[model samples]
Target: MMIDNRLCGSWDMISNDNFEGFMTALDIGFAVRKIAVLLHQKKVIEQVGDIYIVKTLSIFRNYIISFKLDQEFEEYTRGMDDRHCKSVVTWQGNKLVCTQEGEKKNRGWAHWIEDDKLYLELYCEGEVCKQVFKRINS
Candidate 1:
């Protein structure tokens, strides 16, 4: 079977290994984080040529970002980093690699699949959060 790689997707946050060691990392309060933890995120990804727009939506909040592959652009991490930074994403061996440049060091993230399971790794401030998700059938 062949996979398009760019399509509407859904992910359930099975476990969040928030590297921040606390919910304050996003600058949100405990209550918000609690709700966020329970949030079921639906990802809508649209790619046309070298450009892509990805949206992460949930009842709690929604984040939308658009960028061109391998091109450097300014990104504002509204709900995540909450800062303006240079960002870029490219495909590396079937995995999507993203790098964010800003005040924080060692900041970047990657998404890939293994055994039909989706995985996400977020890094910042020398910390990393490993999250696992399982795809569901529509």
Candidate 2:
């Protein structure tokens, strides 16, 4: 299967659900979590060959993670929830699925595009956060 080039673009967050629970699962402080929920999040993805650079940008904090497909790398999620984890992102059909192994249980996220929108499902412990983004540029 061929990867869709449309996945490389800037997406603005349209909605977020259960994000507070997800953040709480990550042990984020109440003040930080409150600020996080109020910030408008934007995601930018740049895919070249098998390498991908993904950025989550907001006024409160910004995070950038770069990795090659099927390669495991140490990811330090700073500015957001500060944690270190071993992460690997692989392609499942047309969706990008990531698995993170570390202190938290069931920690990972998946990214997929549908109907000109980008969907991200973030899960940790029993909490699942769903975020939808509309494509701003491709």
Candidate 3:
């Protein structure tokens, strides 16, 4: 199955829940966590054939990750959290599910679009962070 092209665009974060817990699980420092929680995050997704480039942009920092479907790649969570992970993204129905293998257990994220909003379910260890983004530009 292919990822819905509707997911390609720029989305602005509207709500974030349990993000602090998720950041703590990643061992983020207290100062960084505080700054991170306050920043408005934006997600930009670009799809070309089977390759996908996903970028998370914020005033404090930006994270850009690129990968092809079903292929594993080395992912470095640089500015967000300093972690090295082996990550693979695949399509599950219309949702983009990513599995991350590294020091943290149960680390992954799923992205799906519902109505006019984009949803992201980020999980690490036992903590789950839910973020909702509204379409800003397409």
Candidate 4:
């Protein structure tokens, strides 16, 4: 089935799994990593025109970020990153492809849905991190 671009709108992050072991690999302190791993993170997404805003919320800390699809721009990954990046994202089939260029090499992410399940793949420095989430409806 073909998806409307609006399908990228409003997504809730129900669950997440780290694949690149970035938290541990990046030497994130045990305390912070512990909290991050244990805490439930909810992602709220909104699409207005060609822009997308993603908000990662939790008890310990909250992060708000925005990106434009298919349009390259400077991105500052606050909370998760300290450096600046050049990024762009576009849709491929049912999946969203993201490319981030900066201090880290081979950084990008892809998002998609299947069987009502949410999938996220984050990449950095040749390491690929994958996370999957099931949709929750009330």
Clashes of 4: 0
Q: Sort all candidates by TM-score, best to worst.
A: 3, 2, 4, 1
TM-score of each: 0.78, 0.94, 0.95, 0.79
Best by lDDT: 3
lDDT ranking of the models: 3, 2, 1, 4
lDDT of 1 by residue, 1-138 (tens): 222363336656566687344345445566667777676676555666667777777787899988777889999988864788899888777677789888777677787877777777877766677877766566
Task: After superposing candidate 4 on the true structure, give the runs of residues whose Cα lies further than 4 Å from its correct spot.
Answer: 1-15, 24-27
| lDDT, candidate 4, 45-89, per-residue tens | 667666677676778888876776667988887776566889887
Q: Which segments of candidate 3 are over 4 A away from where they belong?
A: none
Report model 4's TM-score to 2 decimal places.
0.79
lDDT by candidate, in order shown: 0.71, 0.90, 0.92, 0.68
After superposition, candidate 1 runs with Cα above 4 Å error? 1-8, 19-31
Question: TM-score of predicted model 3?
Answer: 0.95
lDDT value, residue 102 of candidate 1: 85
Count of backbone clashes, every candidate in sequence:
0, 0, 0, 0
lDDT per residue for candidate 3 within 21-107, as digits (tens), equals 999999999999998999899999998777899999998899999998898999999987788999999988878999999999999
lDDT for position 106 in model 2: 94
